[model samples]
Target: MGVLGQPINFGVSMLDDKRQEEERLQVLKGYEILDTPPDGAFDRITALAARFFQVPIATVSLVDEDRIWFKSRFGLSATEVERAPGLCASAIFSDKAYVVKNAIDDPRSLANPLVVGALGLRFYAAVPLVTHDGHRLGTMNVIDFEPRDFNAENEAALVEFAGLVIDQMEVRLAAHKAIGSLTTLIKTVPELGIDEVATVCAWTKKILIDGVWYSFDEFLSQKLGLTITHSIHPDAAKGF
Candidate 1:
């Protein structure tokens, strides 16, 4: 018996965590950002973070299932690293900032390779890149060769940088979706002939999808990542 007179099912807890991770990966894939070329916009963010924190390394890290991919990096040559028990992997578990002022002395980070190995990382700080719908994608990271104290103000600034990163990601995702919709619209118009200028029904609000009619609500939710609801406006109701 446990807290609520039920057995503590550790396996069920693990399964829940696994399911959540699967959903988070699905959200990450929709961004279409993995393995893509670097954007100057993301690069600028990393550069600014390094300068702002006076750290030797700063990166926008995306945590894939087995690896950490650097979308943008400053003062670091490698673009990725294995997903281990330290750094971004550990940071993504929480929404708050993760800081290790002195990895050499902190029991939590003492055994991490980045500290014990040749790179000799002494300091680390990061804020998780969380989506608007509450999925943690990765982290905005700052690293240093020498340990230093990071106060509350510094954490707040890092959090703001994370917000900027997520903002840019959302903008990019919207553009990607818009481009896809435009492409579909163009392909459908030619096949439908000059008589039909659009693939959507004006009255029913149904869209032509692969020669089949699908509700506009379905199209928006499936293709554009939008949530749909039904309602009748007073002005529109008068028409009936």
Candidate 2:
């Protein structure tokens, strides 16, 4: 079935809806994850996905304007591939999982270079990585050189794994925002002539001020002479 620009084939739908595409791209960019270095958190999940599905390749892919970049991968050396003819491109159109039992037999993928060219991809299954607000960023996918079928159980597992991937993305985004806020706090606040800046742990959210270890709030209160209060909601706390 064709939606607006092209026919949907190979269990893949074209992500060509102009307005929606723009919105999706905006949300994807908000994560600030594109073109980032691999992390053990994401890499371990991809590796486990490959092992769980018994597939040779698995990846956490982020769909960009012109390419599908692998945030994490197993058994794949390349970091990214062109968007056209890419299975993950189609996977991003919806929040549901997309599966191709045999790429060679699927009209949408028969001509795909990844299927017939050097990589020789065959079986494929991808669960969309959807944000909490319902934007689909990309996919958590498994691949094999030989054609194979994926049962409903397998699809469910893939979806769960995809959720884990999304969770990681959320954590990374949160950490980034926190750092940005910290930077702003440092710059905007008046200089207290505290000549030496203390060491801070980004991951642990611990700060060292005046040669003493303190929680983020303690550090802020001690250094900036500011009062810190937290809201029950995490997002609400962003204001402080």
Please tell me which predicted candidate would have the highest lDDT against the true structure. Answer: 2
lDDT tens per residue, model 2, 66-138: 7777899898776776566567657776467789999999986888766767667789899888887777788
Q: TM-score of each candidate? A: 0.73, 0.80
What are the lDDT figures for the candidates, one per model?
Answer: 0.74, 0.76
TM-score of candidate 2 to 2 decimals: 0.80
Off by over 4 Å in 1: 1-16, 191-240
Candidate 2 least-lDDT 10 residues:
1-10
Task: List model 1 lDDT by residue over 1-70, tens digit each.
Answer: 2222322111101115788888988899889999989888899999999999999789898877776788
Report the C-alpha displacement of residue 93, candidate 1, in angstroms: 1.4
What does the lDDT come to for candidate 1? 0.74
RMSD of 2: 6.6
